[model samples]
Target: MTSESSPTIGLPAGDDVFPVLPLRDIVVFPHMIVPLFVGREKSIRALEEVMRADKQILLATQQNPSEDEPTPESIFTVGTLASVLQLLKLPDGTVKVLVEGVSRAEILRYTANENYYEAHARRIADNVGDQVEVEALARSVVAEFENYVKLNKKISPEVVGAVTQLDDYSKVADTVASHLAIKIPEKQAILALPTVVERLERVLGMMESEISVLQVEKRIRSRVKRQMEKTQREYYLNEQMKAIQKELGDSEDGKDELAELEEKINKTKLSKEAREKAQNELKKLRQMSPMSAEATVVRNYLDWLLGIPWGKKSKVRNDLNYAQEVLDADHFGLEKVKDRIVEYLAVQSRASKIRGPILCLVGPPGVGKTSLGKSIAKATGREFVRMSLGGVRDEAEIRGHRRTYIGSMPGKVIQSMRKAKKSNPLFLLDEIDKLGMDFRGDPSSALLEVLDPEQNQSFNDHYLEVDYDLSSVMFVTTANTLNIPPPLMDRMEIIRIAGYTEDEKSDTSRLYLVPNILMEHALEAKEFSVDDEALKTVIRRYTREAGVRNLERELATLARKSVKELILAKKKSIKVSPKNLEDFLG
Candidate 1:
């Protein structure tokens, strides 16, 4: 097919095949050329497979597997089928290949034996016969691309023109569309369009949108730069004033300042990590002769570190009776679960008690799963930190993104501790069962360390890449169901918070619900309060849930509506009865 009259010969044309190339942001069409740099282990293996195969490899978009596995998907049903024109291995362990798109194809199942993801492809219809205004579309698209090129930062107009005059309109659109800075999903949409006119129109719309976004981004960057410049100048002025004042100091004045600082430093107890950071800052002050406001900024940070509550542990009264009292103060039922929490606190009374027993509350929504964790924290006089695991599919989020990635952060465990402003506090991991599996990574596997007490004491997040002490921290987890991983599930003590029985609901409402509802609905002391019969009527007639929570809401509703009427009608208050339930509700 090389150095021939036509890209594909009509004489005894070989059986048509499509190689499902899975490259992103770059689409190659027949008579359209694109270059790819392959270096990853997957890419290298893919190259090797293609070099060895008798027929060309079909490039395809990856498909996800039904089961949880590391494999990617097959190519999109509509993709450019291409042949590798040339292949050369670079010194940097990358394969340099020139590939030209050939025809449209549908991807079959993944091929075996590949370093890169490859799919078996069968050709779709050749060049469409019913094209009407495709050639005019190509010219108009070319002009649009030329304008797009001039608009792109630093892109050469000559390069754009060369791409435009190429033989295939489909290839031109694909090549230009690939580099348009459109979102991946939008690019996939363009790839999926079946016809030349459709593909061209989609690409044009996407390109225009990309240009608009670029314009907005340029304005945003300029505005930010101006703001930063103003801030830096202000900082420079403040530090210059401080330095000038210090320069006018006497020997004894310096001594006095040093003495005050030394006294504070002596009083300051520091963590090993924070102390080391402060010491480094002091050394920086000793060094770096061409100092600026940034240097002064570092010195200020040192001062803050000296003043911070490092090596400070909050006072926690570890009495089981006290914890029980706190729990009873707010919640009415869940007697069994509350008792277990008290037992946990009793065990904490041991001098050498192992970190806390990881307690997971399994129950339905509004069963006070989150509120209960807060109550436990209040009972122990410790701070509570919550990490919601719902919709957390990225492994980076659960385990922290790798620090090498831009804006990487510590996993939820490390982040929660930092947020609580304490190394040891009560951590509530919510919705542990709702983690999703995706190409980014499985969040469940990422939770392996944070939930495991043995491993969690030295939990390492990918972003922080530092092992944090989670041993002394008490961890609580909540889920609607016990659908958590077996290994993770085994590590925690499961406390079942059953739906309240009808009798329990009625009793709990009488004590906790009535009073709380009165306070929340702003009802006066003399307001017609919710009586036993009225509350019972409302609960039986209005709603039915396992938890008294909904019943409590209904009670609150009665108070709110009646309170409004009490203020409006001067008939101070009406006694709530089964017959008068409609007055409050309606």
Candidate 2:
């Protein structure tokens, strides 16, 4: 591939012997002057040997730059012959040398040396191909290189100016190739080119490829810059609007609302997961527009979260005597149910913390099953909250609707807890057997979590999306029959209240029912009276029920008739005995 050759660099007459210096990560080209720091022992020794003699060294690129000690086979045979212009010894035991690449050379053989690498190489003469074509290619290369320099800021304009002054096509091609920001292999390929025209064509093609890539990069940078500017402009206008609004005395109510929520979040005693969830929701709420429906939902969620009686509980009444008195005063008989409640209170007083038992009071409707729940609350000194599970089919009714639904809220359990304003409350699930199943869901299934002592500690509500503690709540459920799901039934301790006996019903009416009826009818004890015989007659004849509910209703009728007589008939006081019980009943 050679034509008329140019005179090569002067070398030794017999053989071109030079010290070999292996380079890492760089390929030195002819007409390129570069500074190198020599740290390796062999590389430094080679530099010293070259400096001691004719100042010419064989600079070869290692096949693997990572190799600390490169062998002859590991180095490229074609390398640049560089002249050591200047050398400086640094205090760090390394030598800094200024090198100018003289000409391309190929190693003939490596000589054995103990101190450093020694090699015999021959200088490769440059070939000037077809004079006209070489000249034309050289001109085109200079123009493309100028464009490349303008596009690539790393290469200075002075480099392009210096390249334009070279008349020899080989020197022009070498100068441009030396300045290209190409890989070591690509540069070495250009350096190995024997003809000037081939080297020039390769360099020109590389420059064009680099220019196209640079143009694309420039377009991308401009587009990104414009987008950034638009975003900054919008931010600036928003800040300006806020400032104008502030000057006009228009305050940001949204900020105040968020601040209030944040304050509540900090003040409220929430579990770690619950607090993090609230903070995350607050962050989302801050990002949303105040007028949006989503913002309203988030606000409501925050309100519910803060509204819950977290870490707040009524001080349980530990006095067994007081609890027994309250239970005995509220209802007569059902001694088993009253004893169980007293036992629960007794355990609570001794234990530091106890999972309150889920007590299911199963009996007929009028047997004081629901009223027993209230008495237990009063006995234990816990707030009373009742939720009717009657006809409740939707699972959401117990566990709550997911936040994704419109106008979603926490389930009745949480709502009742909020109403009770205590973490530990006597929660009565009334008419639990009336829970129905349909397409909506089986609410009884959801009640399993609320009633289980093991799982209720971290009861999760779908709307809250966080676990709430229900372990401390005394859950009492009332059912007309034991028609509950087995899984749910398994979680609760069943307390059956067989209908009261005739003796218990009579005692209840005299002690609790009659006094309450007379007071409710606005009649003094002296003004209206029902003797024990009259009350028994009313209970056996007019209303015959196991519980005293019907007995109380009949007594209320007697009180009403007595009041009517006192108003219309002007009776001083009415005493209903077994003899006159028929008149009051009629």
Q: What is the lDDT of residue 532 in candidate 1?
A: 70
**Global lDDT of each model?**
0.68, 0.86
Which residues of candidate 1, in runs, are more than 4 Å off? 1-310, 351-357, 399-409
RMSD (Å) per prediction: 30.9, 10.4
- Please report the candidate that would top TM-score against the real structure: 2
Error of 2 at 289 (Å): 3.6
Q: What lDDT tens digits, residue by residue, belong to model 1 across residues 297-354?
A: 5545455445333445556778777888889887877888898888877887674535
Off by over 4 Å in 2: 1-252
In order, how many clashes per candidate?
A: 15, 0
* Tens digit per residue, CA lDDT, model 2, 424-502: 9989999988999999888888888888888889999999999999888888889988999999888778888889888
Per-prediction TM-score: 0.49, 0.59
Model 1, C-alpha of 111: deviation from truth (Å) = 99
